[model samples]
Target: MLTRFVHSGPVRLWTQHLGHPTDPTILLVMGTATQGIGWPDELMRTLADNGRHVIRFDHRDTGRSDTVDFTTHPYTLADMAADTTAVLDGHAIPAAHIAGISLGATIGQWLAVHHAARVHTLTTIAASPMGNNPGPAWTRALTGQPAAPDELPPPTARFLNHLTASAQTPRTTHQQRIDADVQTWRVLNGDTLPFDEPAARQFVEHSYTRATDLTAATNHDRAGRHWDDNRRAPLSAITAPTLVLHGSADPLFPQHTAKPWQHRSRQPD
Candidate 1:
């Protein structure tokens, strides 16, 4: 179900509405460069069907949420975390079962660690624990580029392909479903249809600029600079019940990289 969300910013937030009203809340967080619609609806449905109230919303710079000028300040992950807190507070949700993927997953990681009071159980898929992975050499190289408005399309396509491929692969727990989803999203994202290249580019530029400097290097540098120059605080502070999920074939975040997180996760009790 698609619901109308007009609060929070200049542009109305577009979110997915599903499941029964009485179900417990499970807020789904989308990854970087992706809208909540990119999240698999079945997953939310299943959670709702299992007596959980599932919800997903677009981040400020993604989907139909309000867009801002990223050229002014260096948007840090911490700032993104604050936006999430505001969203939750506005919805009157003190805390809920939280789940996220990739950058969304990273946000969840930060939420559970720094803002534990705001989240209940936590689930992170295809994510890393910042600085733990250090990422790859090429990953570092990519982040070093200039973050201009024009640098949106190709990387956007490549990143989407990666997420689509990761969720649809050999021996995946949910491949057929993911394949259909990829097709559906492709249709929704097509230029001739509803959301075209311009929309896609806008979403990409928004995310890139929001969490990084206007003149910030591409995401590669955003992460690489942090990995090499920054010292990430430990996740040992996270007390929330946690679950970590990753695909063995994921090129961006391989299965082995999940080990660092496994050590810190409190059992979901």
Candidate 2:
């Protein structure tokens, strides 16, 4: 795998690519505040082994990408979609299989609708057709109302702490950071899958070290709140083969959340 930075508009994106250039491409777009490194390396390698080019990148406000405060000048889902296009443009990839999770999936939706020619296939995981439910927590956050404990922020202090501890020069507050990573994954873990604390910690730590800006997650949430509106074009506009994958026990996005896409895409659950 190679790690590099690609200029994408005002912000440069941190990218990782695996597999041969000749292989079919798989472009992975992660959810809001989700680090590209957090994506399973095994998955990338497996796809590469099967003769697929796997590409993943950190969004503007995540990982080694440039961090800009979005509070003063908010960006839309369309802007995010363009960022993906910029990424593809940066790599000179004509077209690729596009897959995203949650917020990233929503961006994928935009790409499929507005930038159809660039997408070979569309796959959304743990996402709603309209992006996400937002629910009570995110709703409150957007409205400037006091958020409940669960809805504090996507990239919580604990998550940052864990990232800090995962650095090459491990901090003295290592235990606390490790604990944060353990708890964070525990909360997001689906019912069918056991929480792998050790693995989770390692992944978070590695990503943290590689990240150029630890506060990118916080900035990502700002843009996320601005575009949290449940918006989507008619499913008929989507021409590529589409796949919607949602975990039955996903705490953030329940099965009902994925129902719209399944119903509209005419794909069986």
Candidate 3:
């Protein structure tokens, strides 16, 4: 793997590349408050071995990327989309296939809509449509509005309760913070899958140790509240071929949330 820093205007993002640059590029965008390393090394290797150039990056306020005070330098998802373009630009790549999870998936939709030419293809996992009403219960808490009748169902109560309890519990020590991350994954992993506590713990520890300022990652939540673009284009604006994936046991975005995306694009063969 090759690591480098890419500049997005004033912000700097830490990016890593695997596989040969000559191959088709796949840009992996991770979830909110999560870094590039959240895309496991094993998965990266598999994609690389398949003759694809894979790129992953730390979002502006996560991992080794530059952290900004959201109060002074607030940014929207549109801005985050621009950051992805910067990563491509830094590598002299004109376009790439985008695979994003959770909040990353939302940003992928934004790129597909506004910067259509830059997106070769889009893969959205565990995400609701971009311009649609919010799908997560936490988003309702953030916006102080209820989901419309046509919108996807909110997250499960069990998951919301876990988030609440986790937020309220203070983690003053490094080990406490690491444990908190492990527990968060346990809840997110759901009941069907065996929770790999050892692997989760190792990833969490690595992320925690590499972070520039873990607390600063909360800036993403703050940024979400202050999205500057009010007139968002509909998901229909996406011209790229799309793939949508959602786990049946996803606690945050229920399986039904994937329906709209499937209906919007032709099914992948």
Candidate 4:
């Protein structure tokens, strides 16, 4: 595994499970606060077995990537999109098929919209258009929602719920996923970071939407946000073929979101 600095040094893409660089590359961008290691092993291996040159990377401020306070430098989603492009440029990959989920999907949308040249095809999993959906309400904990501090649920409960609610897939012993999430979180956040309360509040504080956030925000939810954001440059603007996959049982983003993508994209969302 390698951690690469891109777009100067503030943002890093933690890379993993590398293959021959010459093959057709499928760049996987994970959701918020998740490292490259979070991608399911079975699914990742399946992509490799399918003869794909699979690549996964961590976004800035997440995982081992630099968490230095870029908050002062006007960090926007466009900056994150730039980071993805920089990673591709840094690795010398001319083009790639991009895939993402949730926050990753949000970034993928920005990549497709703002850095069209670097992406060959697009695959978005478990993501919506933008603001006001259940995503916003449910994520009030993460994004500093309800505007009232008293309404906030327990931080542990919020974190646990965030993991479960964000996932379209379900586990047999669901509690195991929660336990594993907490364990991994402990390792990632480190014992020195806030364990009980501070960490959760810290995460929640950074959740607000800034004016410079690149994606469109027309709809009440994430799906509409993406769709409306892309209004000036619809999915048809995407030169590459696209394949959008959605899980039917996902609690956070319903399967219906996939339908709009299918309907709107030049190929599919």
Candidate 5:
């Protein structure tokens, strides 16, 4: 694996590449507040072994990437989408198969609709059709506005409660922050799957130690409030072949959230 920093205009994004440059490229975009390493090494190797070049990058304010002050340099998802293209440009890749999860998935959708030529195929996991607009509750929290009548369902009460509790709790010490991350993943992993606490804790520890400013990751949530893209087109505008994947146990986005994407992409549910 090769890791380096790539420039996205004034921002610098930390990126990693696996597999030969000659192979078909696959760009992996992770969720909100997640760094590039959030894509497990095993998964990257599996894709590389399958005859594909894989790339992953840290979004601004996460991992080793530059952190912007929202007060002075607030940016929208469109800017994030541009950052994605900058990764491609830096690698001298004209296009690649795009795969994203959660907020990353929403960025993939935006790329497919706006930067269609840069996307060969699109795969979205645990995401809503639109950006992080996770229904009425989130809408109220972010924008102080009620959601449209047809918006997707809100996240589960359990998940919301966990978020609230986490926010209220202090994590001033390194160990406390590590513990918080482990618990956060436990909630996200849900009850259906085996909760690998040791592995989760190890990963969180590594991430926390490697981060330039761990708390700066919260800028992503703040960025959501400043989202001002009025030119966002519908999903039907996407011409790339699409696959939508959603877990039934996803606490943030319910299974029903995938229906609109499936219908729009003309993919079987």
Candidate 6:
């Protein structure tokens, strides 16, 4: 694996490359606030071992990449899409298959919508239509809407811990930080998969040592507000073969959110 900085216009991105240049490329896009290194090595190597070149890079405000203050018109989802292309340009790759998770999925969908030629295939994991689909009641509650009488209140304690973890300063001892990370991941783990405490702890420690940015998640969420006007991009516009993957037990985004995308991306008769 090679780790280095790749420039996309004025933005310098921290990137990691695995596998040979001759192999087909797979660009992995991570969701809001998370650094590219957060991607598991096993997953990247598994794909690379099967003759694929895997690339993962830190977004502008995260990890070792350039930082942005969310106050100014900062960046937006569209800018992030362009960042993906810039990464490809930096690597001299004309085009490649893309797989995205959470906010990354939103970026991939927009890339396919507006830059169809640049995408060979797209896989969106654990995300929903951009802005408004009347998500679940939990989503509504989180967004400050009045919860339906029957709807359950948002899980504040659990969610707040995640925010607390993201905003944790590196000033704390490494072990304490890793322990906080473990707790956060424990809360977010899906029911279908057993939590791997040791692995999660190791990953948290590795990412901490690599880079730390307390404001990444908040800045990322701010940047994503660019889609506020047209939250839901037109999925039918995407011509590439697309796959929507969501866990049935995903707490952040319900599995049903994937249906509209699956329905919209179908080929015309």
Best by lDDT: 3
What candidate 2 gets wrong by more than 4 Å, as runs, is 131-174, 228-230, 257-269
- Supply the TM-score for candidate 5: 0.89
Q: After superposition, how far is residue 119 of candidate 2 from its true place, in Å?
A: 0.7
User: TM-scores across all candidates?
Assistant: 0.61, 0.77, 0.89, 0.58, 0.89, 0.81
Give the clashing residue pairs of candidate 3, or none: none
The best-first sequence of candidates by TM-score reads 5, 3, 6, 2, 1, 4
lDDT of 1 by residue, 1-269 (tens): 74746454343455566676556678888876566765666777788778877778876666556555555544566656666666665556788788888777778878887789988989998776643543343343355543332111122334445556655655433444344434434543444334454544444444443332322223323432343222255666679999989755454543332346444332121
Which of the two candidates, 4 or 6, achieves a greater TM-score against the reference? Answer: 6
- In candidate 2, which residue pairs get closer than 3 Å at backbone N, Cα or C atoms, i.e. clash? none
Comparison by lDDT, 2 against 4, better one: 2
- State the lDDT at 246 in candidate 2: 79
- CA lDDT scores, all candidates in order: 0.59, 0.72, 0.84, 0.55, 0.83, 0.76
lDDT of 4 by residue, 137-254 (tens): 4566565554233221223343445555646434355454444455444533433335654443333333222112211221112222333333334444566666777655444443
What lDDT does model 3 reach?
Answer: 0.84
- How would you order the candidates by lDDT, starting with the best? 3, 5, 6, 2, 1, 4
Error of 5 at 21 (Å): 0.7
Which candidate, 2 or 5, would have the higher TM-score against the true structure?
Answer: 5
lDDT of 5 by residue, 31-97 (tens): 8999888899999999999999999999998888998887788888888889999999999999999
- Location of the lowest summed lDDT over 10 successive residues in candidate 4: 211-220
Q: What is the C-alpha lDDT profile of model 3 across 1-269, one tens digit per residue? A: 99989999999999999999999999999988998999989899999999999999999999999999887778878788889999999988899999999889989988888888999999999876665445354577445567554456677777877878998877988788888889999999988889999999998888888999988888877666544343256677789999999898888776554555554332112
lDDT of 2 by residue, 1-269 (tens): 98767886777888889998778899999987778776788999999999999999988877788777776656767777888988888777989999999888888887887788999999998776654335564455444566443221222334334434555443358566556656667766744788887888887778677667666576665665554332435556789999989776666654433334444332222
CA-RMSD of model 2: 6.9
